[model samples]
Target: MQRYFIAPEQFGEHTVMIDGEDAHHLLKVMRMKAGDEIIVCDGLGKSARAKLTLLQAGQAEADITEWLGASAEPLWKVTVAQSLPKGDKLETVIQKGTEVGAAAFIPFQSDRSIVQYDGKKEEKRRQRWSKIAKEAAEQAHREIIPHIGEVHSWKQLLQRMAEFDLVLFCYEKEGGAAGSGIADAARSFHRSRGESQEASILLVVGPEGGFTSQEAEQALAGGAQLAGLGKRILRTETAALVGLTCLMYESNEMGGA
Candidate 1:
């Protein structure tokens, strides 16, 4: 059965109204008809098995059959704070990061960032990344679509670091240090969580050229713990996905429902 995410308001007592792009996809692209079975999610960690009942007037309606409570979200919240990379690398990061269980993405400008997002281009890039995240979340059956934060400057990034409980800075030079690996840092954060308090982690990855010593110093000064991914140096695009995947796995996200 195909899956679609609908607004919470669209879900009534027994039926869900599907409209907009989802409706168009059903009516035109998928050629779905009445009696077809599909999964509809409310995008707030609620999903149900729905059977198509009506398709008309640029909309589709489905009756909820069974509610599914199983969630794929991790116990801990992770936000990928990625520095701007060249071309479409950041897009790839948002797409795959969503699939791997990142709660949000924050693109920041670093000292070594080769690409800069100015006025018109910034808005366009934000929209593009938001769309990519939405599509990726839908395809991956994620309960919530990961938020794409606005691009931030160096100072803004540092200021925003106060929001997360823990921040893991993926530093290339720090991988050789003892207990500086992502697993070690994640374990520490996971252990520090109190009753019913989920750990919120901000995993920071630098740009194509990586962060300068001064930039790394600032991030470390802003309460970010240096974490090395591995011995091998990964590209700017690979770092976020790898970091998120590892962190999720370490937090037992893969083992959970």
Candidate 2:
């Protein structure tokens, strides 16, 4: 069955009127008939099977049917505070990170960051990134779209560390006893019961060149654990995915695959 996205408000009165772009896709591109069945996700926690009851130029309605599923979300809220990288990599980071169940993505201006945005440019960039996150969530069959937070200064990133229960910094520059082995740390974080140090995992990843010693030190001093992902260094985009994947594995979302 074909699947489309709609807001929760469209679900009352035993019918949902598919409007805007979704109606355009159904009528023009797909040429769907009145009896055709399609699934609509509310992007909250509800998905339903419905057949087209009416199809018109200005209106398209689907009749009520059985629900496909309910409540698809992760256990914890994982937010990624990443230093904005150059090029189109930010789009990829937002998309893939959404797929792995990251609850939020914050673009931070850091010392080593190459690209910079301010005022109007920053707002436009954020709008585009939010759209990418929405599309990724629907593609991945996620129940809710991950949030794209406003771009903040590196100092803001350091100050906000206290809000999250677990703050982990993936900085390869930091070495020694402060480090926690990847797999074991993930296991420990996953197994944490009630209110452990990792009840709310907030991961921090740097830009293309990685975090400077000063930035890493500041974050560590602000209660962020400088955890090593592996021996080799990864690009800004690759590092986000790696960190998100590690969080998923640690949170037991990998599902034995």
- Per-prediction TM-score: 0.93, 0.88
- What digit string (tens of lDDT, one per residue) describes model 2 on residues 1-257? 66777889988757887898778888998899899998887877688889898887756899978876546577767898888888899899899999888888998988988988667788888889988987788778877778788998998988899998878888775432333645555566555554323366788888888888888789879998777777677888888888888777666667732
Q: Tens-digit lDDT track for model 1 on 85-116? A: 99889989999999989999999988888997
lDDT score at residue 70, model 2, on the 0-100 scale: 42
Query: Model 1: C-alpha RMSD to truth?
Result: 2.1
Top candidate on lDDT is 1
- Tell me the lDDT of model 2 at 24: 84
How many steric overlaps are in each model, in order?
0, 0
**Model 2 — TM-score against the truth?**
0.88
